[model samples]
Target: MGTLFGTDGIRGRVNQYPMTPEMALRIGKTAAVFFRDKTSHKHPKIVIGRDTRLSGGMIESALVSGLCSQGADTYLADVLPTPGVAHLTTHLAADAGIVVSASHNPFYDNGIKFFNSRGFKLSDALENDMELWILDDHKKPPVIEDKAIGKIFPVSDAGMIYSNFLLNALPPDIKTRIGGMKIVLDCSNGATSTIAPNLFSRLGVEVIPLSTSPDGININDACGSQYPETLAKKVLASGSDIGFAFDGDGDRLIAVDETGNILTGDQLIAIFARFYHQHHLMENQTVVTTVMSNMGLGKALSDMQVTHLKTTVGDRYVMEQMVASGAHLGGEDSGHIIFLDAHTTGDGILAALQFLRVLVSENTVASQLANVMTVFPQILMNVTVNAKPAISDIKGLPEAITIIEKQLGDTGRVLIRYSGTQPMCRIMVEASTKTEATHFCGQLTEIIKIQIGT
Candidate 1:
């Protein structure tokens, strides 16, 4: 990660350091110069999309001014999801795409993420180069004159366009595969508020929508994928067969079954893996997942005779591994799923539809599908820190982790890392029993807090 970028992208509280409008202008300028030089286009075309945050308009305006001033034409895909921006970037053959969203963060927070012309996230080297350009003191944005100035175009009906794109990508029997299902959708009152309702309605299912109203500040407030309990309760009250919750930018998905039981992404992945292997739906009998995925998923995949690959915590890392291994499917435990055959990035809505396909094709309920994996007892705890020090340098932290790892041996694992986006440390422990996992995680939590607590 760069000084201004995280594992995902550039994110922070609105109006703060890198997220401020002034910084957004610099980012736009840097992107215009960087992509224009990399691509052969004299007047590079860039697409800009954003979630429904109050600061979105402010950021987009500043970015546009910078890009236009730098001689790059910009297309505005207002209030669209992150993946929608990716799709638009490729669909319009633009030089690159930029999304102004903080994803699952609150409305008070905002972010910027870039996608190349091929609709994939920029690599660390590319981001680092852009960061260097943005911070370079001697370099200045060129002043264009006359007809050389760039223009801004509005990508009207962007939501509908992306919806149609997703629908068209499904199988010919998609309607039959997902027809007549009763479902609940929690859009998190963010980017998917409009797109999800419009997209899911075409599938012939009775959809009960919740949290679709975005008041700017309400995005991800005790709802969405972060709190599947909200969707679970609604599913039970509405008597829906299943429910799905999407984060602010519609890149992650968490689900609720007919029994109001929330299913983890690992569980859903296992179900998909088993079905694809039985039906021979996968082009490569391989699936990519992050290290955060439950160990049970690997066991289940092994039993089903499928190749499983693990990457770092981020979706970009998962995507890189998928590409390298020629795997068509990849995702994280937090619900960011990628179907590389259909889309270049992780898409929550598309994953939901694909999950629906499995449900109907097998003629079963989500509660039963969840049985594909038996989750190992796991606990993830985050501790706010005054400063982020290397975990190895924190006194007693490494020794404690070592002790736990030795005790765990083959039955479990311990992973401790700092949050790439926040000023905190996360401790994750998985063990054969819930009690053991909890005990070990508690020990690490206290150690982290004592070492760097505020």
Candidate 2:
């Protein structure tokens, strides 16, 4: 009876609650019905893809069975990125696309997200309709004739199509100029395991790939974006120009500088914004980011006389705001960068390519490209509690926060918000220097914990 989908999708630990195989089948049928057109007669078609999660096989089969039961044709593009599913949906003109992935979450978790025919994430309105159908038990099984049962076929070129598209999206000179550039990529052993190495090799970069495995459990296992310490060390040890780490689903990306410094999504945006401007590719010279972006990014954009817009924290919200504002580039601080000129959804592989394009075009190094923006030191700490209280009910919390704000003044910023995907309150502080930011963050977190700790 509760809402079936979370901020991203229907996610839970494998075999638990919403993630059970039975529920997955139900969701698949509901999705097929929602996308079915009675007049098509050729059968509604949908494409399904998944990350390297241990539960992906079970979930994928359940989805296939349910979709077929509705007489909906299905295409299987196994072990592909989330964006690849989105791309294939629109490219092949399928009625819908389904992806089984939990993105940056650990291997124990899994999820199901739908993409509309246009290759964009489904709107809240459409999801609401599906929820209504599920509650009313309006779903109908297929009334298929003996020959009308839908068929499932494999897409042998799914990775090649996505990789080729990413390469073409770059400026022509990038491939030649970045041919000798040395870079390390940690694919998280998920979706990028197939596409990334081929894409970079085709681009002529000296690529060193880590975590390249088909095994599901290996994804994000002390590598990848969420666990960057391993990648940081690898970058230094390999002495590569830099490194890029992707999430399990390959929609998000984080970077390591030549000095082994981790670069967050905000810093990457600032760098790309500057590069795009230098090449006259930044339309209206504006960039879109979430409120979670660092104050340093705003300062960098302002210094360049470029515009910056802030949306809510999620990539979906960023995409919506970008569309409304006619902005071409937008993303979250968690490495979910979107280049409207490249792909409908954020693609980690594409993002890395774009970064390479800029470096090659300007004949610059990764460290030099990174210098386009000066990142303020940021400190964030999350406090887990029994319940998430309203921001209004906590007395003196606001006053204490105000003190930190005044302390930082114009040189920094503070963000205190709740984690939508988890039960925790996060306190973030950004200042001109790391020491000052850490001190303020420590002080604020201690105060809030005392006031709200269980």
Candidate 3:
């Protein structure tokens, strides 16, 4: 169980060291005991959900066995989005919720993350304690009598309940104006395959679904948020007003305009930030995003006098900054938008709904709305590394950055960091032109590859 947790939670290729069934069982036992002791609920209870990965059932069974052994009555939300699991945990009054997924990753990769009773990620302190407990060799789950053993129950209406709750968050005016909109959805053949279509139909929109059939291994196979070209083409061919591509777990969204151009999350954030500021919807006139966001977003938000607070790469870090600053709107370039005024965590459908509302209310097309910010030409490159190391400690990397910084000046920026969930160093360079960005990125990529690339 050595440092099984990452920026989000425990994730790896299924059947591997920390991602194996044994580790999952230990995690289940530890979480069951930890959250059980901390909750004010009448009894120890937990809700478990998963995406459409083939290994989901294997890990889910292991988790259930461990939870039941420790007498945590487990509710199984068979195939639900990560955010839906969070909602069910809070609504069902469970002590905690665990989602089995590797958002946006391939089907072979799976992960387990938890939400507290309030539908929020477990605090770092809680996670640390749980990790320590899981790692302790002397700690073992106590055997319970048959009568005291926890039982498993199914949440048959989890999708419906979550969808209705999302709809309820919308105002009457937007809801009324949103009808008659024709939209396309590429579900990524994962958790949102059914739920997103169902939710959109409830809003009286004509739904055109793509990649909705999940065959376990097909999830995120060049068909999701990470690959929106297919969705963009469909929107053009079908003549739909807009298209949305959701990641495997449905916590991220990448949208395509009517012109078949995929809109970056930075563009979407710029739109929302300006709209929130104009409508006085911003809690502190702030919009928080990751450092990976396009520089243009910062310039646009700054021009409009909206505070553009930047955090580290992870959505967890973004959420922390947003909560600390009381910002109502925050997102990432990866499309993990968190609307504090709506749901607790990032919900792709919820963000899509809000974006659609803006489209309707402003009486503008998505392409025009997206033009709220100019997207700076950016290039992102990833290098596989043999081991993780502090970026500051990477020899020669700092000097190279300083030199590149001098060259770019005020027109652009560069960001280099390790992926929290993968063994890769991501290099992002933004410049006034793609040629300049590529040159800068190539320089950094070679240095990192020479230092640590596998």
Candidate 4:
């Protein structure tokens, strides 16, 4: 009965608490009833998509059963990316969309996220209403008549449709420039395994794909954006122009330059912002990012005369700020970039294409393009904790953080926050040198663990 939604959605180990089949069923029924009441459609339709997790089928079946029971037609787009579900929801004009995957998490964990009819993540109010319905003890409504019961349909071409959409979204000149370009891709053995290879090959790029074979358990098994070392090695060995690594659900991207250097999400965003501004495509000449973004990105944006807005540590918050400020570009430091003019949500493949477009249009290599922003030395430490005690509640934590802030002054920054989806405290420090950042991060993490350790 606790709050079932996190920063992203309801995520947990499979067969546990909010991720259980029973919980999924209830969520589906609750969502169906809520959307039905909000819309005038006689039979509200919900499109469902999932990644290659082993539990995806189990969760999908439970959701479909519950949705149909509430007279909400369900369309299953099996094994598609999260953004694809969002796109298909709006493309099909469905009432809502559901994606069942834990994104970058391992196969042992899973999650459920919802998108409104406009392909945007549901608002907090809507999520709260659904949680209430799930917890309510009111009697269930009568079952619909046999003919009135919702039907389930299979989307046979969902992946193809999404792939084509991404292909067409690229700049027209990309086709000619990308031809004969050698590129390596690491699909994370998740949703992008099939679609990414196909799309890149059709675009006439020499595609060297890794982790395209998904056995469900292999997704994100040391090969995705979270672990770009493998991709970097491949890019160097294959002598490819660049390497693109996608997270499990294809909502995140991390790139490896030709020299085998990994590029952070902030660097990519800086590149895109500069390109968009030079081309007069940047709306309001602004970019939105989260607090977790590197300080160098802010400095780079300032140099370019583009306003930088920082939001909470989530892509949804970034998107909300982008929409509010009329900014066409926003993303997180974790590689979740949103191109408002292109797609409703972050699409790894699409973002990669945009990155490629920058390279092609500028007639530059990945290393040179990534140099658009100079990243300061950053150190992040995740300390496991028994509970999420507020930093103010922890004795001496506030004074210690304040001292570090004053010592670093304007040359660096410090961010201490608890993970929204996990039981840990993240300590991030940026300084002029790696040694300073690492030392300070180690000190902060030890303090946190002593105060809140299990």
Ranked candidates, highest lDDT first: 4, 1, 3, 2
Highest lDDT scorer: 4
TM-score of 1: 0.98
For each candidate, what TM-score against the reference? 0.98, 0.92, 0.97, 0.98
Tens-digit per-residue lDDT, 268-335, candidate 2 = 89888887787788878889998889888888999999889998667877888888887888898889
Model 1 / residue 193 / CA error / Å: 0.4
| Full-model lDDT for every candidate | 0.90, 0.83, 0.89, 0.91
Query: How far in Å is the alpha carbon of 438 misplaced in model 1?
Result: 1.5
Candidate 2 local distance difference test against the native: 0.83
lDDT of 1 by residue, 1-454 (tens): 8798899989898888878999999889888988999788889999999998889999999999999988999999899999999999999999999999989888899999999999999998998988888889788777778688789999898888899888987787866668677899999999999889877887888889989999888999988999889899989999999999999999998899999998888887888788878888787899999888999999999988889999888999999999999998889989999989899999999899889888888888999999989999999999999998788999998899999999999999999888888777889999999999999999999988887998
* Candidate 1 regions with alpha-carbon error over 4 angstroms: none
- Candidate 3, 9-120: lDDT as tens digits: 8889999978999988888888778877887754588999999999999999999988888888999999999989988998998888999999988999999998988888
Q: Which pairs clash (backbone N, Cα, C closer than 3 Å) in model 4?
A: none
Q: Give the clash count for each candidate.
A: 0, 0, 0, 0
Alpha carbon lDDT at 271, candidate 4:
92
Kindly list the per-residue Cα lDDT of model 4 for residues 240-290, writing each as its tens digit.
Answer: 999999999999999999999999899999999999999999969999999
